[model samples]
Target: MKLQQLLSFTRKAVDEYQMIETGDKIAVGISGGKDSLTLLYALSGLRRFYPKPFELTAVTVDLGYEKFHTEKIDALCRELGVPYHVIKTDIAHILFEERKESNPCSLCAKMRKGALNEAVKKLGYNKVAYAHHKDDIVETMILSLIFEGRFHSFSPKSYLDRMGLTVIRPMMFVNEADVIGFQRKYDLPVEKSRCPVDGLTKRQYAKELIHQLELDHPGAKQRMFTAILNGRIEGWPVRLTREEVKSSS
Candidate 1:
């Protein structure tokens, strides 16, 4: 039952969003975490018996946690036969030592994403996918609403026009709980890492708070996702006919 749900959710998102095509070579960004591991595994499951011809590769960016290592992840990728690339960057030290900002997670994420985007492009992969899940989309939507004064969420399919790259989140429809459950069911090897501000960050607080809100209102989480799925929250203006837009202009 669990496997069926996971596969259905993934396949629907993939087909509906057109994340990858028959000949597209996709590079997945795996961070040695459950969300990423689940995503890679799901893609593996899809590829094993999939009729279409496509390619999958794994890339992990070493954020230089020192305590955080990549050997285990390397072995996992080897077993999966997913060609892996590890790019090491001193992101932690840079965030802690150079800028010395009290809040480093946000900046560190930006730096890490920039490094990954550049690496994937240089490595000659045309499509790059991340493992952001439903919870992440909800949290990001809430964050944008409260902090950025916008209720926007990142699209399942988005293009980075400046870089000529396509960024995709193939796990957008699945939630964190399901990913964790799958990890436990499959006994996936997840290496532990020590983030400097592990529990002191705002996102951690948001997760806890959101969980509490869901507890208070039983269907809150599902409702939040449904809003996205049905496009109830996106504030994009309605597209108009050429005559209408021309008259407005």
Candidate 2:
């Protein structure tokens, strides 16, 4: 995907949700991964030309993985002149040792989120932005439906209780494929996850299924997004309005 396309996509999501405004202090969550790195770079680029007043600082939650590296992330932020914070927490050890669970992706994610929330509160940021994209939302929706019998997915903009900070997904409209493409185009720094049983998790299975469907039928994934935004609720595990149901039916 071209940089111009990414600009328009990111602008739309931010504009629609009013995520950035005059004098807003936003914290971009950086995990030293492709997604977060791309997000930080995009936001930084937008800042130069954006007609509003907003400040962004990079923040990372270090889970104390044995092979994980924060140096690269630090160098990027430093090069960009963005202030960053490294939260030192031994989440990986807790997930592996205490839990003793073979696959701890879900728990590990929750712990990371909790750490992020706490960090936001401590740092006094008005908004916290994550790198969750369209694919992550789709996979999460499916996972929630199958496992919890719930219709829940992360919103582009929402309020957190403990942190009392607005959580925003500036990349909500971005596709994972596009992100991967951007990574290739821009050559952003990325680190491999140190989680040993990473692909064994159920979410990985969901991701593979979604990937296969996207290959089998082009526009199938886009239609799924359109269906959700268009208010069709059959595919989702949630209550639906009569109008939405009739419109789809």
Candidate 3:
């Protein structure tokens, strides 16, 4: 998708969920991947003319891998005129060397988020923007159902009461395919994930499962996303109708 298209989808989610407020400072969690880079571009572009003024900061937590680097990400942040911060941590070693746990994704994710949240809190940002898109939302719901026997996915906007931080998914309406197109069209500085188990996880399985379901049913993915919107999941924002949106604007 083009930058304008991305901005439209992002702005829709942000407005529907009331994610941003005047004088709000949001930290965009960057993993140097296509999705996150796309989010950075969307938010930076949105910042220019959105009625509610806000600030953007790009942040990436370096997981202490030998080949992990953020030089390109730093340059991109500079180009966007957003401040960039990289928090160096030994999370890689702790996960693979020290603790040596068999199932590391869960623990590693918790550690990484903990580190990111602490750094964001220290930076005085009130909110954090995650890069999860529409596909991710549906895939997560599938994962929860298959593994935990529950029908659930994350909300577009959620509050971490303990940390006093609000998490917002502005790209929730953007598809993963669109994210790839945007990255290629813009030549974003996408970085390869250095994680040892990058694609060999349950999430990957769920993603592939959804792809197959879409192929078989031809509109299954869209139906699932629609279901998610109308499911009344806790903490999910009440979706605004076209009339409501017009009135609000």
Candidate 4:
């Protein structure tokens, strides 16, 4: 997964979902992980010649973990020439020390997203890019089915009415394996997640299950991804491209 490969997948998702528009200011949520860093690199490269020029800002909602260091992330952002912001929050302490919730992932995620949305809004960014890839979409769908008894996954593009912000998943077409490869090939400065429950969450379980299923039934992952794209799920419709509109007319 070289930079060109990343850009190709990203552009496909962006074009299919109509995720970007000229003059759009999109903020990339930097979790200091491989996924987010790869996203930053892809988007930074995309900005060079993407027909619909858009600006980007890298943002991270620091959860106030003692071991989390963001200096490398700052340097990466600087090297990419993307402005970065880290919203400091005591979310970890609140979830672990004060509230002491048995299930803290949900609460921590909510707090982090709230902080991120507020920060982006204040920074005047109307759109945010999350690094949810193909695997994440499939795993989420599986999780929903197994846990919630429903088939649902996050959309490639979503508009948060309250926040007046749109969320885009430019990496939706990229595979998690490719993301990992990209990180390694590019030597992305990945900051390890300091969350205590990082790999013990429901999502992590879903990921393992998916991996086993793929091993048992080869090509299962690709089949599932195809199903998701054509499943007619809400907000999954392919936006009409300009060429398609012209041809139809």
* Cα TM-score per model: 0.89, 0.88, 0.98, 0.96
Per-residue alpha-carbon lDDT of candidate 4 for residues 158-226, written as tens digits (9 for 90 to 100): 999999999999998899999999899889889998887789999999999999999999999889888
Return the candidate ranking by lDDT, descending: 3, 4, 2, 1
Higher-ranked by lDDT: 1 or 2: 2
Highest lDDT scorer: 3
Inter-residue clash pairs, candidate 3:
none
Residue 85 local lDDT, model 1: 95
RMSD of every candidate to native, in Å, equals 6.1, 5.8, 0.9, 2.0
Question: Which candidate has the highest TM-score of all?
Answer: 3
> Candidate 2's residue-wise lDDT over 69-151, tens digit each?
88878888888878989898989889788878776777888899889888877888788889988888888777877898976
Candidate 1 residue-wise lDDT, 25-64, digit = tens: 7889988888888888878777776555678899988988
- Model 4 quality (TM-score): 0.96
Clashes of each: 0, 0, 0, 0
Tell me how candidate 2 scores on lDDT.
0.80
* lDDT (10s digit) by residue, model 3, range 171-199: 99999999999999999988899988999
Question: Over 4 Å off in model 3, which ranges?
Answer: none
Model 1 TM-score, all chains together: 0.89
Q: Determine the C-alpha RMSD for candidate 1 after optimal superposition of all C-alphas.
A: 6.1
lDDT of each: 0.79, 0.80, 0.94, 0.91
